[model samples]
Target: MRCGTRWARSNHFRSLPQRPDSMSIVLTPQELRSHLERFPRVSLGYYPTPLDHWTQLEKHLNRKGRFYAKREDLSGLAFGGNKVRQLEFLLGDALAVGADVIVHGAAVQSNYCRTLAAASRKLGLDCHLVLSRAYDQPEDQGNFLLDRIAGVSIELIDEPLGAEQEARKRRATERLAAAGRRPYLITYPQSEILGTASFVGAAVEIFDQFQGLPSVPRYVATAAVGATQAGLLLGLRLLGWKGHVLGFSPLNGGEYAIQEAIWSGIRAVAQLLDIEPSLEPNDVHNLADYAGDGYAKVSTAAVDAIKLLAQTEGVFLDPVYTGKAMAGLLDYFQKQKIPPEEDVIFVHTGGNTALFAYHREVLSLL
Candidate 1:
């Protein structure tokens, strides 16, 4: 593979010095082949998603800095999302393991479920989703509508906040099994490891993408989940990228949930891929400041950020995740945590569909 300084000029490249210890965990071309030896991955996504700079948003924020976005939303499985990459590896594993049905639990607007449903259809597996409908709203918004249109079997549990919905998913899975169908739980606590591995795979691509940059990025930011952040951080460490990987949480949950998920994902990536690196609990940074009010609640700041991006950059941000993440990024700029010369990359995990559903809420901001 080619490597050089000019390669760093592109928005995607972040230059960094080579780590001697990187060899220990770094997968050689041969090692990558061997490491992914038994892993079956289908052509379910558009790999090497473009890493382009959000110049308009950067200028609108008036930051003395560079802001880039990795368009993971264009993953091309269903409507696109960061989950597609994970689903590529995950659904591949499900098929390899002979799972005839896929089941997961999340909120009604889960992009993962939408992608999972599409992937399951492609793989000829039945997809089931358990959704928590705590808010009194129709399910025809964003991903919820997509899930219905995808013909995914769904069970809506009307539980308030703090309710444990995992049990509902388990019950749904059991129902499928009782009906003589083979069912697999796709969003178990244990699946974080597998999910993280998918991001690790993504990080490998990023390493190649940035092979020729002069100055490496000081930080990389993405929406927090057990898998995406965990996998990227672990993969970056494996590839000798020493910059900070920040996982900004869109949810209003305590710090523990994100940390636990991150650590679990890191461990999973290390063990499954045979990569070694020190990942401490303290090293995990989950920014909850942008979650104004709570998860699913659209703060004024987030709404403003979303609208600003759309008007300035023609980019749509979901009210739940990316909007809040962008809010956090802007907050950092306002607080002067990020200097102008530093390179900052934001992972656009994608949920623009949600913006349409929340159009009224967003319009009110104007």
Candidate 2:
């Protein structure tokens, strides 16, 4: 729940982790792209997902500033999400290490594990999930159903995201090793940098996409905890972007805990890039105000957001992730934390399937 403890040294890096160079060098978007591309990766999702204008949302909300959605939901993988970008680098390392299977542990309906399963199947690799049966998704729906369809092995556990769930993943890894299968446990912090590092590349994508917009966004808001937020922070900082990243969390970790994980992730990604971590942990706008009830639980605002976005923009936001984040963005607009006249971008990390899993909750509001 608290995003696992701070990242210990990750052992799965594509290259040896190095300290950030003491020198500060401002890298252009093009230069940063070069630096990021040096790492090993396998293409999975469609890159540079469209930064489409929320053409109708402005008038729908009667807002002054323009709004846009960075369409990560269209990331063209198994029901796209922000995780697909991370997995390209993650699975790349998995294959490089001669691994035949990926062992991942997460919430029962995690978008990360679901996308990972689909990516593994696409690559002809096996995937074994150690899912925490902590949430109330009793029926096989949303990500769980998709995982079932993918035909990956599942070891369901009664525990939440504490030690036992993680231990199950370790035990599964041992079993696989004994069975002569090369396994890559994604929970292992070692190779996580590979995934987060790819996000720096995402920042570059954002920078390039903004060129056609009215102005660079004042805030880039999304549902993120650790690696995704870290990548955006590091990559944006590296590109000398001035905008803030509003990381709206759906999980109920104290703000400090989530912020610390994000900070640790930022440092790790910077080390991998061999660049100075110029940003501080406090630099992250890790807001929990919009995290409804907690991870996977429904919230009134999120449902309203889902309904509003679907009706106004013909887009759907999942209960677990994007919906809550959309709520946060709207709240910011309402509270004037983000001036209504200032342009903003919402990164839609997809999981609309989760809507079906919350039929009772969503339909009650609808």
lDDT of 1 by residue, 110-199 (tens): 777878888888888888888878764447677888888889898888874333677666677777778887777765444676677777
Candidate 1, residue 33: the lDDT equals 41
Best by lDDT: 2
Once fitted onto the true fold, the runs of candidate 1 whose alpha carbons sit more than 4 angstroms away are: 1-38, 62-64, 160-164, 212-214, 253-256
Q: What is the lDDT of candidate 1?
A: 0.73
- lDDT of model 2 at residue 147? 91
Alpha-carbon lDDT, every model: 0.73, 0.81
For model 2, residues 1-366, the per-residue Cα lDDT tens digits are: 111232323444445645445545678998788677656678899989999899898898787888988888899999888889999987876776678898888878788889999999999999999988877775477788999999999988889886798788878888888888888777746445665687787888998898898777878888887777778888888878877999999977662377877777778767666788568767987888888678778999999999999999899998878889998888888889888788888889888878878888889987
State the weakest 10-residue window (summed lDDT) of model 2: 1-10
lDDT of 1 at 170: 65
In terms of lDDT, model 2 sits at 0.81
